[model samples]
Target chain A: MNARLYSVVFTFVLTTIFVLCLAGINALASGTIEKNEQLEFQRSLVYVFNIAEDIDSISDEKILSLYGNRIEEITGDQTVYVVNKDGSKELAFAVQSPGLWGTITALVAFNEGGTKITGIDFVSHSETPGLGGRIDEVLFKEQFRGERISSDPSARVAVVSGQDTDSKEDARVDAITGATRTSESVQILLNKAINSVLPVVREVVE
Target chain B: MAESKKTVFLANIWKNNPVIVQILGICSALAVTNNLTNTLIMGVGLIFVTAFSSLTISALRRMIPKNVRMMVQVLIIATYVIILDIVLKAYLPSISKALGPYVGLIITNCIIMGRAEAFAQSHGSVLSFLDGVSAGIGYSLVLLAVAFIRELLGFGTVFGVRVMPGGFTPWVIMIMAPSAFFILGAIIWIARTPIVKKK
Candidate 1:
């Protein structure tokens, strides 16, 4: 056999064997991975709503009993996962925005009047670990809870450095020290979430 | 024979460490070392991929044609990495999520490729597997050391538990990739001093 022909046959055989093995493993694990994703999403939803107990302890049956019907998919936008909190008074949705390194996807919950943040949770981010990534810290996220957005269109939530923002009603947050870019990105994402998604959600719920 | 196996295994852990000495897989070291928990998972995942892929490639080396051996080696390595990714996602979703694209990036890790090319291609399956495991362990040890310093200085925590007393200001630079470079350079310098002196 020619060396080149032998190499081709050998490569083909090796690739087929490798692919078959990976496909088998993937098939076996896919169901479990899907279930885990669904559970994680549900858990994040629960967290954004401030349902602090063990999400696993709350059964799927219970979730269905609580906010299962409240979950609705917008026709054109798949990025938004809206959870209606009865009428048009409160809602939560997932938003994605570019972070310092990559995309930061977060779940932001807002009051029915669209004038305040009820809660927030980072769904995913690719920010630098330990630095900008600290934006995902619970302490940082907790600051957004009950933060009132200024009703004036000219006003935007400001993420300022070295500011005293202990008051959640102030519509401002002290940026995580040294993570100004990530904090700024979060502020931009918050504004986009409020301006674009909230009105659509308000219409559907109201 | 037993002595040779031991030598091959021990060599990678110290004299030929994949991180400090060889500097093969430093990308994930910088990316995942911010937190101890994520670093631990990443280390374990790398160990599994390197060990199993080495075993598989070494087992098939005899029949693999020289002309296409590198291609075959990569295919085998990629398969094991994907398997690791899937398993982690299924069994350890939180860690998997934390790891994110880093797991897929394992396929591109030069350590795995270097081991396949240098050790596994010429060695018997069992010996190559040991070599791979040792190399992975070597990488993990250095990464954990780096992660320890980074997490402590950056977050004032170890494995997410606050250890520093109040008023201890965290060093912002310690959490960034540049810090990993400095820490890793210092580690490599310290680790290589004795090796260089012996020569």
Candidate 2:
């Protein structure tokens, strides 16, 4: 065989074998990966709804059960998860906004009257970890549990940096230090969600 | 013609340390060192990729045409990295999420390719594997040291456990990438000062 031809043949043959092996491995694990994602989304829904306690320690089975029993899925322009709390209906929906690197997807829940936020959980984000990504930390998300939404709609929830957020009803959360751009992005995202998405979803639920 | 296994392994760890000596794979070292847990996982992932890729490259060195050896080495390295990624996603979803794109970026780390070109191309499979693993260990040792300081001061924690008292205020700069630059530079200077003096 010609040396050049041999080089081409060897490279082609090696690539085929490796790709086939990767395909086989991916096929084997795709099911489990999908299940993990589904379970994670269910976990986020459960967390945002605040239906169960000790979310981090809560078992996967418990999350699934809580999601299955208490949540109602309404699919439309925006998918909403509704859970009835003490005879009043609370609604949660996934919202997307631009972040430092890419889109930030958050599951945000509203109180029965939509006047205050019940809870918030970050579903997915591409922010830089340890800085912008601190949004996923319990310390940050926990502040949204009972924050009131401003009626002006221009700024429903404020993510102010270096500010004291002592009260839940203040409708403000302190941004991660040294992450000014990401903090600003979060504020913009909240305003968009409040001004555009919330009223439309509220009408649909009603 | 083959180098002794101990010399090959130990040299990569200190004498020719990938991060400090060769200066390869500094990108991931800086990116993942803000936290201990993430840095550890990244280290393990690199070790697995490098070791397997080196072994495979060494075994196929004779068969791979000289003109296409680099391409063949990359293909092998990328395959191992993809396998590591798939396995992480299936078994350790949360850590997988934490590491994010860094896992996939392992293919471009340069340490594996450096091993393939400088050592694996001429070495036997076992020795090449040892070289790859030691290089990874050397890289990990430096990264973990940096992470220890960063996580301690930045988060007032070690491996996510709150070690400092409640009133301890964390150092905000330690949580960012520029801090890694300063720490890694200091580490390189301290590790190399003796070597430079002896020479």
Model 2: runs farther than 4 Å from truth?
A: A161-170
- Which residue pairs collide, candidate 2? none
**After superposition on all CA atoms, what RMSD does each candidate show versus the true structure?**
3.4, 2.0
Chain B: TM-scores of all predictions: 0.96, 0.98
Q: So what's the TM-score on candidate 1?
A: 0.86
Off by over 4 Å in 1: A53-89, A98-103, A162-164, A177-181, B1-3, B161-169
lDDT tens digits, residues B78-140, model 2? 999999999999999999998899999999999999999999999899999998999899989
- Residues forming the 10-long window of minimal summed lDDT in candidate 2 chain B: B1-10
Tens digit of lDDT per residue, candidate 2, span A1-206? Answer: 99999999999999999999999999999999999999999999898888888888999999988998999998999988899998999998988998999999888899768888888888889987877888898888888888988766656888886678888778888988878888888778878877888889998888
TM-score to true structure, per model: 0.86, 0.93
Model 2, position B105, has a per-residue lDDT of 97
User: Model 2: which docking level applies?
Assistant: high
